[model samples]
Target: MEAVPLEHILLLGAVLFSLGILAVISKRHAVVVLMGIELIFNAANLNLVAFSRYDPSLLQGQMFSLFVIVVAAAEAAVALAIVLRVYQYFKTANLNEIVSPENK
Candidate 1:
């Protein structure tokens, strides 16, 4: 068995990041946007792990990834709470609809 090349791992991470960006740009629902954000976070974690694999002793990359995970969890909670509040007031989760004539 052979180890996968670093380039290959990086490429996967890039693909994930790109998809995340596409989702964030194209999606309208708040939950979908949150999912896309999670995807981006995972891609970053993939990158951190890959780089840390090369420097096993320091583990800084892995540590930072953990910190990112913690931050992401907090972000998700806060963002979801905000989304719920918005939905409660506006009665719709569609971002476009939320910003329509009545708002203007």
Candidate 2:
């Protein structure tokens, strides 16, 4: 019957975003980086939904969140395809290995 506080939701989102940033920075695998990017997108979506819940006049935040979800899905598909191609060409999924000039 009671609603959760907006600050809690925002804090959760911030934590997710920070974790995503850390993953992207610390991981060497392309797939892990993509997952981190997805985490960042989900964090933004969480913030959008939380704000939308507080404002009843319009559902723009929810609509935009839907759009973002769609875009993130498409982006994931394309990025995975690219990663697959890179793996096929380079025989590895490690970002550093793929980019190293010695490999070329």
Each prediction's RMSD to truth: 1.8, 1.6
Q: lDDT (0-100) at residue 19 of candidate 2?
A: 93
- Each candidate structure's TM-score, on Cα atoms with residue i matched to residue i, is 0.91, 0.94
| C-alpha lDDT of all candidate models, in order | 0.93, 0.94
Residue pairs with backbone atoms closer than 3 Å in model 2 (clashes) = none
**lDDT (Cα) of model 2:** 0.94
Write model 1 residue lDDT over 5-42, tens digit each, in one string.
99999999999999999999999998899999999999
Q: What's the CA RMSD of model 1 in angstroms?
A: 1.8
Please report the candidate that would top lDDT against the real structure: 2
lDDT (10s digit) by residue, model 2, range 1-104: 99999999999999999999999999999999999999999999999999998788999999999999999999999999999999888899998876656756
